[model samples]
Target: MNNIALSRWTMSYFVTSLAAFAIAQALMVLGYGFPQAAAAAPATLALVHIVALGWLSLLLCGALFQFVPVLTAHPLHSNSLPLPTLCCLIAGTLALVCGFLQLAGDIHTGPPCFVFAAVLLAAGFGLVLWNLGRTLWAARPLSVPARFVAAGLACLLAVLALGIVFALVLGGALTYGPALRLVHAGLAVHIAAGLGGWLTFTAMGVSYRLLAMFMLAPELDGRGTRLGLALGCGALAVAIVGGVAAIGMGVRTSRVLLIAGALALACLVFYGKDMVHLYRARKRRKIELNSKMAMLAQASLAAAVVLFLLSLALGRLGQLLPALVYLLAFGWLSGLGLAKLYKIVPFLTWLECYGPVLGKKPTPRVQDLVTEQGARKWFLLYFAAVWLGSAILLAGFAPLFRISAAAALFASGGIAFHLLRARLLLDVKPELRLPDGVRKPNILYSFSPKASLR
Candidate 1:
């Protein structure tokens, strides 16, 4: 077995990101934003950024740091990058949040503040791109996960550039004839690129390797894997380019959007079929909770596509777009994130504590670190609320949306509790049996890997 060296700061990112997720959920439950009267309202914009930047982006970065080595069979270019990256991301995200609140009349601030915040965020993202780029380039032979990660990095760069331009326009720092138009139309592309191009693609890439590894299944079929990546990239390019062209030329790109949607659906179908194949071929008969819940996330992606097409067919895409966003953000992206974290946190804990002692003693398995059966309820509630909330939002029931949001809040809180417990090794006893019948207690503290300790 390969010993993957994980960064110590990875958990910091996880903790902070989960905290951001919880805060964002609390805000939604309290009706600070989301399900807004105007989807483009400042409050809605702020909330969206909170989830995107503060929650998902941070989580992605952390996972990358830990898994990049595992994917490439090489340690990170430097362990030092993660600390600065975390600092920049957290500070910049807070600034952006404040700037957004300023726009919402929740605070008073000049437009330049928004520009400043965006610049800070760009700096943060730049650091991460450079760090990961060096790491990926150092690999001997690129793997599928690396390809997906590289593509995701490219999308992140484009998204950051477009995001900075939009920020400048919002900040009154730069004004061009078509800038506002692009900003309006580009918002759709931005979401598509950020969520679909960057987040979804990267998650799929990571899960491809992780699912098989966790389940002791064979690697994904090469032909299907390549096809999925190609189609997924093509879909992103079409959506992004068409969206920009439509905005600049003031033309209807509905056909282009439809084509992109179709390509994305095809990509999902390929991915779904591949996942089903892996599950069927798994050597491990008992599926873990994380992998099980991840299936729901995949199902949610299919559901989102179905809902999006239905909206288009009904000519109510404008009204129903938020519903689509809700399903994608919460059910697909977040649902998968939470599910993975369930396993990741505990596995990392085990690695940190017992990796050195492996082959020398009998240690607790990664599965022994967390109470999966307990977390299963939270996972169930989270998805249920996402489904119910999305339906109510589409139905124009504001009150019911709030109620569903509160349920989501509870679910997220439950997940956070589990994560913390796992990290602290609260559920596991301190003693372990040796192969020769000796018992070692608390040796984990002395023998813990320095890389794990950071």
Candidate 2:
């Protein structure tokens, strides 16, 4: 197997994505976007897109660039792809945010701005899909991660196409008052595709491989993983098809959507059980801080699933919808990404700096490049604040909800600080190294049995 190293520029995704998260949190606390009273307000829409596209989407693209190659044993098609992808995303996101702000201000000019933003964002998505899709196409017989990622790219394509049409409607380029119903139905479908089909699917696929690598665990159960993927894809397809019917044919397929939701919940249960088995079968006795926090994130995902089903059953799904979004976005997606970043940034830094010097001199192990002790408290605080915020949002206590948002904002700040420090290799106390005579130093990120340290 060949060893593959990802682009150094992928770090751009880490820094910029976290910055966008901080901005979104601040907007929530300040009542600019994500206001408790007006869930569908323009500012709220802008904030959601920022988090979804600029933050989460960019982060996923960056990680996949690195890990896709790692999983497929094939290097990225182009190291240059990430830098341009970043440019397009940043520009498009800023334009979209501005358009939303204008709409919130009741400006007549908002529609045109939205159209322009749509064009830019579509271009960005086009580049990303082409790049990643090409890489996957070249590799024969995709791995599970590759399969999930390819599925995600497909969903992303659907998302962008729908978004462009949505933007056109808002821009008054399409005038069918009756067709506006389609927009409403499309909204829910869009969120489902973005969150469930794209983000959740990709995260699950990556975690299966990543957790095993980090924990020295047995490889994930192939049959179980494939089954979960199949279920999830089926669920997403039903939801998308039902949504299209509602939009194009003006048919409300609520029952179809409900079935999709049930299938999705089942998919989660399957993946969760597989994860538990993976943890139990691990060879490593000592679990790292990142993995510990990741388990919490996984728990949050499960909690979010339960909440969805309960809301649907009780006929209170609307009341609890925002809370579900909160749990999924911050608690599940952001939480896992943040926890993993603690390890990824440092490990990448170690590879770039210390890996070359291993035989020449005493060098730090991957674990020594970051201080887990310093980051654990922050992780705990972040999750606690997320839970509190989600509960407060569901309770319909406006002032209290804002307070919880503030707590989340502060906790996110702490996380950003720790991640930045790790990226910079600041305040890292090198652990004692083995002498040259004791053992041969392992190559970082290599697949060869002689090269792998873990």
Candidate 3:
């Protein structure tokens, strides 16, 4: 283990991200987004941003703040920056949501909110890129995981710049010819960059490292892994270039995007093969709950890919795209995140509250801080609801979709409660408690003033 210093604000990020996720699910249950309204409806846009910027982006940022050091054996440029970053992200997301509500005619606020949102989000993401980027750069010749993060950061910059343009255009601050054309045709490109390049690529990289660590499998740096990375990069490059070209030519769909999709699919195939190899080669005889839940998440990704191909073959790609996106966002990405947090929260809690007393006193194992048996049903329920909801949406049944969303929200709440239990050290046995002198950490933050593990 690297034994790096703890990230003081990571738990705060996790808490906020979970709250955002629950809010997004609540919106779904209330029929605020797709299937209830047009895919491009302002309410749907608000819901999407809540999931993207508020939930997944914040979660990823927190993970990276901790994970980058492990990958590079170096510290962040400055730990002080993350709290500020979190504040900016939260404030910006709220402003952006309100701006969208204004567009939906539910509020009367004007262009200033949009511009403020764009500025705040840019500042927040820019700080993240600077901190993590500098840490990776100092490591010199980077590992594959580090390379993935670097590429993802590049994609994030592109997404941020495009988002700024989008916000300005929506706020009527940009009426120039090119900006207007991009406003009309660039949404798909923005989605491709944000979801495909930034989120998926980063997730792929993080999962490669984390799965190996958790499974007791060898680190994979073979040709297959390399090829998968190359293909993913190629796909993103093609998508961005093709998207820009389409915007310039005043078109929406392009053969270039098709080529990009094909490359992305091939990348997924390689990634899937690597995952199979990891599982088959693992030394751990008994897989834990988190790994098991992660397998379901991987299965969700496979299902989404299969559905996409089928929809394309049946000439229903446009109609099915929203369902496919829902599967990716909720089933694959969010599912994987929730699964990992089930383990990570306890592990970090153990380190934060138990590490200093390890040699001097008895302590609980990390696993002692969580009850996998009690939590498993929630994981299962969450995935089931996500899959059922996607199917209902595909079948054009909005009411059933809302019901499924409610089920998912219930499952998510159950999962969050368990994570909170872990954070609070509620599951640790009385005999394994720290000695009288050692202070237990706060439920959602570290107790140490210096934020060092030792």
Per-prediction RMSD in angstroms? 3.4, 4.3, 1.7
Candidate 1 deviates by what RMSD? 3.4
Q: Which ranking of candidates, highest lDDT first?
A: 3, 1, 2
Segments in model 3 whose C-alpha atoms lie over 4 Å from true places: 249-253, 448-454
Which window of 10 residues has the lowest lDDT sum in candidate 2? 444-453
User: Which residue pairs show backbone clashes in model 1?
Assistant: none
Structure candidate 3, residue pairs in collision: none
Model 2 residue 119 CA deviation (Å) reads 1.5
Write one digit per residue (lDDT tens) for candidate 1, span 332-442: 999999999998888777776666666787787888778988999999999999999999988999777888999998998998898878777677756652334322323
- Listed in order, each prediction's TM-score against the native is 0.93, 0.92, 0.97
**What lDDT is reached at residue 145 by model 3?**
80
- lDDT value for model 3: 0.88
Candidate 2 lDDT for residue 53: 86
Evaluated with lDDT, which candidate comes out highest? Answer: 3
lDDT of each: 0.82, 0.78, 0.88
The top-ranked prediction according to TM-score is 3
Error of 3 at 199 (Å): 1.0
